[model samples]
Target chain A: MSVVRRSRWSYLSLQQAPLLLAFVMLGITVAAYVLFFDLRLHHLPTAFAWDSTISNALPLVFVAAGQGIVVLTRSLDLSVGGIMDLTNSLAATHMHSSVPSMLLWSLIVLAVGGATGLVNGLLVTVGRLQPIVVTIATMSILQGLAAWVLPQPGGNIPASYTNILANSNSPLGLVFIGVVAVFWLLLRRFRLGIALYAVGNDAEAANALGINVRRIRTSAFVLSGIMSAAAGLFLAAGSSGGDATGGDSYLLASFAAVVLGGVSFFGGRGSVIGVVCGAGVVTLLVSVLFYANVNSFYESFYQGIFLIGAVLLGMVVTSLAQRRARGSLRRSRRRW
Target chain B: MRNSLRGPRSSVLAIRLAVSALVGVLMTAGTIATASASSLAAGKDAHFTIALSNSYIGNTWRIEMENEFKSACKMAPIKTAVNCSIYNANNNVPAQRSQMSDLIASGVNAIVTDAASPTGLNSVVQEACARGILVVSFDNTVTAPCALKVNEDQYQMGYLWAKWLAQKLHGHGNVLMVTGVSGTYVNEQRDAGAQAVWKKYPGIHVVDQLNGQWDSEVAQRVVSAALPSLPKIQGIWCQGGTNGVLKAFQQAGRPLPFTAGEAENGFRQLMASGKVQGYSIGQAPYLSVVALGLAYEILSKHLSAAHFKTYNLPLAPVAVQNSNNVKGKTWFPSLGGDFFADVAQTGTGSTVAGLCLASAKSGTACPSGKLVFSFH
Candidate 1:
């Protein structure tokens, strides 16, 4: 009876790892905010501070959410940054003052994003190309196209549109986040989502179980592309302009967010909610450092160290839990 | 498998080699055009070939500077007397150094550069000067004594602005300072200048400071974020992105304070409309043309090298005519919000520096004459 109980406890811990990591990240974000507030009473953020923080994290959050799905299927989308640049350029160049024009251009941006993803999916699935090579090649092509479309960063984005997207009181930003969350929940209920996990765990076994591994992988890339485009729109809205090279920094940050959120780089782990929290943690770290009056030159260095620490801590916890479980299993076997 | 890959790899290598060879040949041909165009200084009928090597073309200011230089190249006596080539590197110091080296190799009579580094390109500048090539470094200049320098006193630009803000606030108020990109020499010097002036006035309290990155968007975002955490501000001292700083105040529903900012169109517009009380100053885009004119004068032996080894161009305080109308001669009512409005062709005569806003924008050749340099 004791052996069975011990095994159950270990199984529960294994299942709870990602969720536990997310809670820890959320705790860190709160502590950072409190420290930032304590630096000066006047520095205390307003009631809507959370809203603004969410808005700031929206771009990375969206990308990480999609990346979480892709990682679960054991694939990576390196082309997300390129897609973002292309989308940002399109929005800045075409989205004008009129409401109808803005709506029209936004749809066109989404379609372009989806089309780029479709191409990436087809290359990976149908062409049997390595995902990294195919995505990198596509990223280069998209970057060149972005540069061709808008050579410089100047474009006229209407103030009204920017205000709506950037305003803390506005529900528009929340709506975008909510849509992503709801989509992830609905995806969890679908057969494709289950197939993603199964294929990631063991592709041959999943194939033998009648799962279309190729289709699942292709769908993951498509979703990631769409998410990156949406993030690009958010960035365009925030900056009220276009920069072809601005999205370059997000490429690495997204990977860091994914790993920090407890998504295994190897495959078959993590959740969308955890990824969002991971993005929040990364953004909050920067804000905390900024408010703490750290030199801007050293900010990037501290961010790098924090990311490494989070990843290493996650690895340590996982290995320790696994070792304990293995020891318990041996003792149980000996007693039997 | 290795043999199969080798077939495509070798073909790719061959294609790359062919492409590089074609590029090399075209570059040589282009350089030859400039080299052969240089006329003897003895003959008024001959034209001098000059090349402008700019390190970064990522900002509006650089674009405007390039346009001004191009227009000046096409303008009058210079147009008939000078041929100009422009090369831009994307903010890489090594790349710019190599580009300058290539310009030196092209055998141009003069090379004008807006350097990427103050010291990184000193060796290249020295080499160019040693080759009898007139090298003039403008904007972010080099430290090489051989290269002629053309720039505004950046420290004074900051000092004057801070002095103005201190007086406007009666030397007693909480001020928020918005700075440019950190670790940049310009940003550091400007901060030091401001601090020097502020230290003189014990009442003038700087409540907070933040990096605005010399970018309007970044300035707006950071200022907006910092607003909720600060006390009431009576003054703002911004190195750049003044317009964005003002926009942040507006968004936060605060009254406009006494502001000293760089010359941006939106900031000038606000000042002209009486929405904000401030002074605007800028390192003019026309400085490039000024530098080029200096280079030409030196090359033609019209000016003494000793007189212009180190030149400080006058920093003009952008004048605002308090008219609600944007039709003031100094500010444009029709141009985009990002256009630098203080652009004027300054020299001895109308014929020599006859640069207009249209010519600067369109790169059309305007009439040129001899440019008199005010050496200090």
Candidate 2:
């Protein structure tokens, strides 16, 4: 058997299309800022802008990345929002000014998130339940639990927590984002990562190859839960409080980020890198619209239009590449 | 070719579903509309830019609240002195925070807000305060210590309503407590106040408590469901969706009990028609106008933020005895059941009074074409 080799450029243009889309989205965000504020490129990256934008978008970034993982495994976790709400409630209610309590409660929150994910994973794999049904049920249960933990939208998250996690005066939170990216990069090299892609590509094939499909799928969910918990902690920090229902908004937005990131819902494709940028795009678009002074009533209209446009653009690029590849293959066949 | 065709087709379907879902999410992310009227006379120089950053606009009360602010901006002094903008965040905390950041960046003189969360906006509100921008939050006020708040005491609203219900029952009755959305600051405060009043009247028993969610449809459903299980609810103390609760009683063919609830149009209509005897006190929609006026007062007058304290506006309780006040000014007969009746101040004061229904419905100026807001 002979193997065919492709150039780096070809692989990047075709396989890494999501990154390209992310770049386009980032471009639009920058253009929106410049056009609306009438500022030069040099004036774009202020510490204050970075601080506010990154801090606010940080929670979404983690959530979308977790969602990206779930999507990669061809599953949906509707309970991400509920998990976020529960963990946020837990962190806000228990985390004190002391470092030990903060650390201790943080672990507890993460553990709770993992436990919830385990439940989802077990139900999906062992119980043979649909992912959507399982997650929807878990979502409701988690939201109720969140309300039980913090009956009202009141919790004393210390100023030190806010400063350390998501300070408004500094863009230090970007370091945490970098850490998430690095974690994703490292995971890509592991056996579990390969198994995730293989199982998502084809469950039967993966099982035949002895890849432990159930375990891989379960691990993906566990990772997603941990990430969502991290997101909740960041949300609590950003808001400087705890709210039982606060995580409700992040649910749909995570799916939006996954789609915009060009992560195929069919599974076995895309990167969390693009998902992070997609989260940024989702967030930056709001600021861009605000600065552009678009009529408020039509804000959602524009957002929908933009999402469709981006998806269409991705499809067009992919189809063009596919046609080019087919043409080359036909020419080679004739020559042979 | 079949494989490729089917792949793209199914993927397209998935993408469409995702797109529509995203759109649905965006639709509720809120609108950022600039309501800066350009037809101002060119004589006065004291200009201030005040923005109303509201949390949700899905309900009638929120719409009326925003309309009042716009109407105020178009009237005499505010029209000339203030350039107003309105934004709705659809009850999303992050969305509101980003809007707050933008409002700060734009360097608006003041921001009048009905916050999504009491503490969710504390960080951004603090940033705004540090920037010397006056932040006045009304209705669902913020927990930011630096921001000025203008709101009717939610506790007082519940306390007064419960007190009225207790009196109507002669201090002995099975009253059903219909509370607002659970896990909310306002709902908790209001529920607590009502419970306090009930505790004093040992005979006044709260047999069942239902979560109305402050929506008419939900209130109707919950009240209807509970009516069967309940043993003769003698009095109804509804936090909101007053009309819906009454409609449930009517549908069930039960006698209309003495009620105390929000200033919904239908509730007032029932009282005016002698179909029900109750007290109506609303967490006024004009609270936005009040907050706007406060922001202007601090900005146009160059008053320091320290000069003002949390203005807990008095609740204007309209009793069932006052049928004359129900139809025209307090409650509009032409309006829908959900329309909040407490859109304008009924009495003469240095505050916003004499506002017409058009001001609440469509942001049109009153006949007076003048707005006055003075703290005395």
Score residue B155 of candidate 2 by CA lDDT.
85
- For all candidates, state DockQ relative to the true structure: 0.01, 0.40
> Residue B139 CA error for candidate 1 (Å)?
0.6
Determine the backbone clash count of candidate 1. Answer: 3
What is the DockQ of the complex in model 2? 0.40
Please report the candidate that would top DockQ against the real structure.
2
Interface RMSD, one decimal, each candidate: 22.9, 6.4
Instruction: Report the poorest 10 consecutive residues by lDDT, candidate 2 chain A.
Output: A1-10
**Which regions of candidate 1 fall more than 4 Å away from where they truly are?**
A1-336, B1-45, B316-328, B345-353, B366-376
- Tens digit of per-residue lDDT, candidate 1, span B302-361: 888778887776554343324322454456767765667667633233212466675557
After aligning candidate 1 to the native by TM-score, how far in Å is the CA of B253 from where it should be? 1.1
Whole-model lDDT, model 2: 0.81
